[model samples]
Target: MKRINLSDKVITALKSDIASGKLKKGTKIPSEPELMERYEVGRSTIREAIKTLAMSGILKVQQGSGTFVASKIKSETLAQRLRRADFEEINAVRSLLEIEIVRLACLNRTDKDISAMQDHLIQRKKAIETDQQQKCTDADIAFHVSIAKASKNKVLVDLYQNFTSVIRDFFTKRKEENMTYFARSHKWHEELALAIINRNQESAVQLIKTLLNNNY
Candidate 1:
């Protein structure tokens, strides 16, 4: 029983250490004897804990070469990061980042930019009614991408696209969902389009933040 508890305890501590970068990637773990002494656990428990972590892709165990944090495992890309990233929290990041982008776009967006957004909104409306769900998803992505590009800063545009992919992944992995989210999202985006067209940068920023917070 002590061994079982120790195994779990060591696993948790090791995971925390790895995530904090204290146990750097590709750096070998202490020997079983060392871990047992440091943790005050039996060798078997230490071994078992290491084995579990290795199986989970959190560690690499090379026979005789010793156990090390897996090089490919990164806290930023891990579930630990997502545990701290609540839904719509990303929208806050977007609001902060994009508010400035909108200000820049106000100065930079050309007639072509407005035309592109109009075409995107049209397709988005049509996609919403279509039976193909994937088309609807693509249109949603495209609408946002167009707005980001209108900022005329290629870096901001790319960053927003990256963020969009992550947000979409979260939504796709959820259980029960409602189309009401889509309807509300579309309405808010319409407001967003109008604000941009008028070059009301501040209103566009605030409206996007409000829409993200309220839409759920």
Candidate 2:
């Protein structure tokens, strides 16, 4: 992993404080002198950190007044907050996005997209049969990503790709707890593939919702 600089560390600490309600919205952050003392950093490092946070919409800097938490942060800032969220919270958001992906995929998928999804489903089944947890997880993510691509929406595809880590973490934790998770997942993948291929929009949506809900 790349090393985090002192300024980045300061940004993360401030963000954590804000998220934990220690620094509420519109609350003024510590002054430069106080921050330098608190973080044991020099003037330049503290100024750079504050500038970075302000640019990211996590902070608002005033010429005369001290820096305060922004009243409204960017959506990307909100996504950063969600990155630290629990599995259930992440899964709930994933399910909502993927349900729409499935609906659009059923309406828009091409033959090639369907073929790719089929291949991913086969890969998932084989990985599960061989008890290859990592391969199974990769194939499962690819299967959903294939559906996202079939939706013909670049933004949706990118959003799903961004969620890949959270999705993988969720799968890894569940598989560790339940040995049969992948086996059941393989069956659901097969059903989902057929639903998308047949253009069964409702079935595709419900199948994905069920899979995310662990009803498979």
Q: Tell me, by lDDT, which candidate is best.
A: 2
As a TM-score, model 2 comes out at 0.64
Tens-digit lDDT track for model 2 on 70-162? 954333444555678876777778888899999999999999999999998888888878888888778878888999999999999988888
Candidate 1: residue 57 Cα off by (Å): 7.2
Q: What TM-score against the true fold does each predicted structure earn?
A: 0.62, 0.64
lDDT of 1 by residue, 80-120 (tens): 45446765676667677667776766667788888888888
* lDDT of all predictions: 0.75, 0.82
Q: Cα deviation in Å at residue 48, candidate 2? A: 21
Alpha carbon deviation, residue 90, candidate 2 (Å) = 1.7
**Backbone clash count for every predicted candidate, in the order shown:** 0, 0
Report the number of the highest-TM-score candidate.
Answer: 2
Worst 10 residues of 2 by lDDT: 71-80
